[model samples]
Target: MNPCRPEEPPTVGVEEEYFLVHPGSRAVVPASARVVARASAALGEDVAGEFTEFQVEGRTQPCSGARELRAELCRVRTALADAARAEGLRLCASGTPVIADADADVSGDRSGDSTLTYISDHPRYRAGVLQYRSMLDDFAVCAFHAHVHLPDRETAVLTCNHLRPWLPLLVAMSANSPYHRGRDTGYAGWRAVIRSRFPCLGPPPYAASLAEHERLATAMAATEAMLDPGMPFWDVRPNPHLPTLEVRAMDVLPDVADTVALTLLIRALVATAASRAAAGDPGPRTGAELLRAAYWRAARDGWPGHGADPLTGRVLPYAVQAQKLVGHVRPALRAYGDEDEVTAFLDRLASRGPGAERQRARMAAEGRLSAVVDGLVRETCPDR
Candidate 1:
């Protein structure tokens, strides 16, 4: 047994990015600067700016289980919503904005240029835009990020290795962005496709040791290809500032319960992997090409469609894939008192379908993309 292993399960923290849209028009508005300013002033540092001026990100404090995670997520969402309302804008948790009217013109007096208007004015974001150009503009997407605490950097890196094969399953579960720029993108999570354009964003290569991971990062940073160590935006990577593994595969889920469920699933998965690593298991040896294909398949066809089996790379029913994932992490789930919640949530998700399916259904029913936005805003502000 590993003496360094903590008695308690790792704590989970969630970071969610949202779009600030005009309540009536449903168009993404360049109001995040104002909204974040007011929200951060009222809600502390958790409220922050995202890549685009139309987006805001909220984070939760590290929490032990689904109960505390759910409460903290709700509080953060409520705080963001309250602040957005105070600024006369509505906050939405959808992965992509439903509205396509980019020329809506956010400039009141400054510059008077709408093309140069939507990107955030923050220095880091500006640097990203300058470096990536159209790619950054195409990334009006939001995501639900989970941070799972680990004992040390070594364990964090090892957990990422063990966690690789399972990333696509989580992507399928949390696939939320179907509609992009006012039209159906024909993919459950178009955000994945958009984010893939980044040279540093994707599944990480297998590292022989923690030193290998550092060397890869150092090389990437050396090329000036990435802004910093944090710029190598792997689907799962060791957090730059925290002793945690940050999973970025999932789109920004619409429902709070879904978000909490995803968090619990991630926590369980990481715990299971860390346990196995402690027991001398080196994780799966899946090939890089197969892994990339698995993620692409999930992004293209979420739940209710076929998913690549995590272990074998064979096509399987989405339900079957989800079952396999649950089986893999069940022990950790029970340890954290999350077995029931995770199982029930996945079952319901399979039965009713994920947010992408629901969005498509609404678009079909109402015969307008705006209705999808309406549904997303309603789901985002469930308490309202």
Candidate 2:
């Protein structure tokens, strides 16, 4: 049914995208090339370019435990932040930058900031710009991507198939991109909607066997509709460069600890699904159309808001879905020794709410998106 047989425990890695901004004004700035040059010189290849010149990404080596992953994230964030500061810019790690349109106009009018205009200078990125044009321009959003190693392509497909239903709940938990183009976008995670604009995005079709998976994917790839195999842009997919299943649903979290927490949950989910597969149990049978609708609900109204349960299709409070998810993954959490940390993290998140809520709270109280940016800058790097 699956391609790869059991091998060893999977490793975890994280790739986080950040906004390069003026520390004083909190405006997104197109200084990533300079910052990346400095960061790569000091921190090596883990620091790299994103879709646009206003964004930079940091990746970590495959790690075994949450503690190890946490330490690496802390180091990577510190190094990148330092690199940005050295270039007279700051790196803010959130799903979307909080720069008001007025600030962009001022910077654009003054220095030709090109905050929203400059695409990354890579060949593929340029190709994408030429091909997508306006669609590409509308997508300056960022996200936190997590990769969980699978034994081989077969297992990767299995994990991705099984993980489909969980995508919406995770999106709700990671919702952070409420503001876009300087105003509230009316969606908790606007990045999700923007990303779904790609023809090859959203949930992949279920593959009864590895042969079916390969056939479907090959056919799609042959059309050249997408940039590449990885371009499908499904919320979860087999990594193009590694033997892993990458989860891309979660928006970039403001806190490094929260990032690690979500990473742990992702790994646990994969492990749990793999075990079920081993026992000859297929995962949830949610239809692709329903999955799409559920994702839309989560993106439009994250956390505590009503969302359709992927398993039952019943509209329920997000809190109910979250609890059910935790219960479903309890065995994996226990096996991975992540139960305590995850429980605490969930409690904290529920107490304060997702980044979108926090941002709106700041806006409501201060009546200024600038203040939201100020708070984001302070919380971008873990206290060090």
Best candidate according to TM-score: 1
Tens-digit lDDT track for model 1 on 1-384?
131343357888999999987878888887887888787865698889987788999999999888899899888888888888888888887888778575743232233333456667778776775577666656788999999887477777777888898888888888899988878889998888887777778788777678888888888877866777654678888888877789988999888888888888888888778877767777787788888888889999988889787578789987888888889877777767887888778877968789999999998899987788888888987875
Q: Write down the RMSD of candidate 1 (Cα, Å).
A: 2.8
lDDT of 2 at 229: 59
How many clashing residue pairs appear in each of the predictions shown? 0, 1
Model 2 misses residue 298 by how many Å?
0.5
**RMSD (Å) per prediction:** 2.8, 3.6
Candidate 2 overall lDDT versus native: 0.79
Q: Which residue pairs collide in model 2, if any? A: 3-154
Residue 51, candidate 1: how far off, in angstroms? 0.5
Misplaced by over 4 Å in model 2 are 1-9, 100-117, 222-224, 382-384
How does model 1 score by TM-score? 0.93
Pairs of colliding residues, candidate 1: none
Residue-wise C-alpha lDDT for candidate 2, range 1-384, written one tens digit per residue: 132222234689999999988867778887888999989976798999887778999999999878999989988888899998898888786687677345343112223433335677778876665566567655677889999887566666766678888899899999998987678998998988987787667777787666776677677767754666544566777777787888988898888888888898888888778766666666677898889899899999998688988888899988888788789878777766887878877887779988889889999999988888877777788462
Regions of model 1 farther than 4 Å from truth: 1-7, 104-115
Give the true-structure RMSD of model 2.
Answer: 3.6
